[model samples]
Structure formats: C-alpha cells, structure tokens
Target: MTVSTDPGEAATAAPPVNGNAPGRGHRGPVWLALTLALGLLLGIGVGLVIPQFLKPGDTSPEAGFLRDMSTHHAQAVEMSMIAHSASTTPEIISLSSDIALTQHAQIGYMQAWLRDWNLSPTSSQEPMAWMPDAEGSIVNGLMPGMATPEQMTALRAMTGKPLDVEFLTLMRQHHLGGIHMAQEILKLSDDKNVTWLAGTMVTAQQGEINLIDMLLKKLQTA
Candidate 1:
C-alpha cells in the first residue's frame, strides 16, 4: 500500500503467509524487468513482420477496437504492477505478473499494427464509437469496468488482505469488460489477424476471471 513510484525506494515488507514470504517463487525485480523487455521486443518483432494484408482504415472498427483496447490494457498493466509490487498473497503476485506481461506485450502488437496502417494510435474519434449502440458506455472518458482515478488511488493506499481483495475484484471486472469488447470485435471484424487476437483476449481473460473468482472467494473466507 502507498506504493512508491521510485524504483530506488524499498517497498514496505509484507508479512509472511503460510510460513513463506509472498513472492517466494516470483521473479525478482531484475528478472521481471528483463522478461517484460523481452516480451515487448518479441511482440514488436512479430508485429513488424506480420503481413498487413488487410489494412483497416483509420476509422474502421478494427482500428477503434485496437486503440481503445490498447488504452484499456494500459490501465490493467498499471494496476497489476501496483499489486505485483505490494501484495502479500502469492497467488496475486503471480497473477499480477502474468497480466502485466501479457497485456504490455499485446500493446506492442496493437501499436505496431496502427503504425503499419499509417494510423495514429491516439484517435480523434470518441472511444468505442465503432461499436453499434455503444453510446454512453464511457464515463468521464473511461470505458466500461475501468477503475476510477479515486479507486486507483485507494488501491495504492491499501495493504495486506485489503489490497489483495481489491486487486482481484477490480481485475475481475476489468477482464469482463475486456472480454465484452473482444467479443464485439469478433462479431464486427473479419480481418484475420484482428479476429485472431480478439478471440485470444476473450478466451484468456475469461479463464483468468475464473481464477480471480476462486482467489477472491478464498480470500474472503479466510
């Protein structure tokens, strides 16, 4: 809780759980940093070579979904990093690492596609405008299930079981929103690459949602 932005600042030590410190098996900071770096590099390498055989126009549903979902994934990465650095629960630490690495790499692919299409990653169009009847789903420019700034701030200030519970709860909602967008894209787009990635998000996030639910129940009962 009250996580420091400075890498040089030592984190507040979390108490041991079940006779082992949290992050016992988790990657150290150096390895985590390297793994994230490697993931992005690999993503960019693949994205650059992937044939942009079906280039979606600047305002196409494919572009909008990529742009908006990139933004959505960015927040998830931020939240996950916060939890990963501070949570006492081993399950949460590991889950946070997986989410952060996976989404950050996906962002590399999404941005590379936009670059290949000669499109701006940041759009002039309103978020989710490409989806039919998606009006008013955005609140204060935040899309569905995104944590409010206040909630993120609260999450930073929490510790111990509270941090673990809040992270799981928020992430469960985040995954649901992500799955909804991915599903809508699958219905709306026929571009092979876009559909493939969207399908992946739907499947992976749904599975993660199940794990999050199980973890939340265990935390609550404990």
Candidate 2:
C-alpha cells in the first residue's frame, strides 16, 4: 500500500506547526458553534427533504440502520477532523473538511431519527444485527472499516506527510466498509429517506475514495 513518491520531493515543505499563537482562544468556541449549527441544519434538512418516508418503529431495520450508521459516520468525522488539523497537504485538508462536514450532518440526521422514534441511541441487540449477512464483515470484533484503538492513536500522534498518507489509507478502507453497510441497508429497508441517505453515502464515499487514491498517487510521486 506504499505510494511511490520520493521523500525528497517534499523539500520545500513547511515544518508542521506545534503550538497555537496568541489570541486564538475564542476560535475554538466559534468553530464548535459553527460545526454544531451545520449539523443541526443538515439533520433537519434530511427530515424535511423527505417527510413522506415511512417512520420505522423502534426495533425495525430502519432504526437499526440509523443507529449503526450514526456510529460509523461518527468515526469518519473524527478521522477527518484529525486530518484537517494535522495534515499539511492542501488536498488532504480540503478532502478532510468535506468529509467532516458531510458526515457530521448525517450524524445529526440519524440522531434526530432516533429522537423522533422515541428510541434509545443504542439497540438491545448487537450492532449490525439488522444485516445478518454483514456479521462476517466485522474486523477486530468491530464493524467493517472501523480503525482500531491503535490506528486511531497513531493517526492522532502523526503529522505532515505521514499523517496525510495514513489518513488517506484509513479513510479509504473506512469508506469501503461504509459503502458495504449502506448498500446492505438499501437492500434491507425501503424507507425513502433511509434509502436516499444510504445511496448518497455510497455515491459520496466512493467519490471520496477516488479522490484519496489520486492524492495517494500524487504523494507517492512527490
């Protein structure tokens, strides 16, 4: 999986920044507010965009899909946030920001569904139980495309080009796994909103994966 780009190609690269400069304290709160607002708006948009979709009872496949996909979307958002903060590549930053914003909105969307259904965030049954066929797709006792604790730790600790490469790799895998889950939900449930979201995930993540592959190739050659 190693890209073939030369390390010497990065000779002009700026050293990674380690500490925040003065008077940046308010920035964090402001960014947090913006992110939260975006998520809220997107969540409401999902509902209003297609209110005709069937409302699944608490224990149905629709509920399970929303619950499981929310967890999945959360990780993608986390990894993207890390990449946006740490990776020096402009391409990586842009890609990460796109993923973070989109998935964050989807998280809010799924959570809103659960709230409307009067269901708990989690189900009594095991995760992914909605798609019995996907049980074997689990990795390290987790769902498909999840980064293990070690991988997430390494990602957080890394910076610069290394961070860019590793994040691309991890996200590529994550997107593949997520696409699988989304595709399964399309087959398992017919709720219009659910199907639309799942289809969107497939299309959007696959497009991201292609962009990542291009970036990886460019990095390898750099």
Task: Score every model by TM-score.
Answer: 0.75, 0.74
Residues 1-222 of candidate 2 have per-residue lDDT tens digits of 564466655533433345543444548889989999999999999987665455687778889889988988899999999999988788999999999999999888889878886788898878788886766877677788999989999999999889999999999999999999999889888778889999999999999998999999999999
Q: Assess candidate 2 and give its TM-score to the true structure.
A: 0.74
Candidate 1: tens digits of C-alpha lDDT, residues 25-58: 4557789899999999999987876655457988
Pick the TM-score winner.
1
| Candidates' RMSD to native | 28.0, 28.7
Model 1: lDDT of residue 42? 94
- The best candidate in terms of lDDT: 1
After superposition, candidate 1 runs with Cα above 4 Å error: 1-54
Whole-model alpha-carbon lDDT for candidate 1 = 0.91
Deviation in Å, model 1, residue 150 alpha carbon: 0.4
> lDDT at 20 for candidate 2?
49
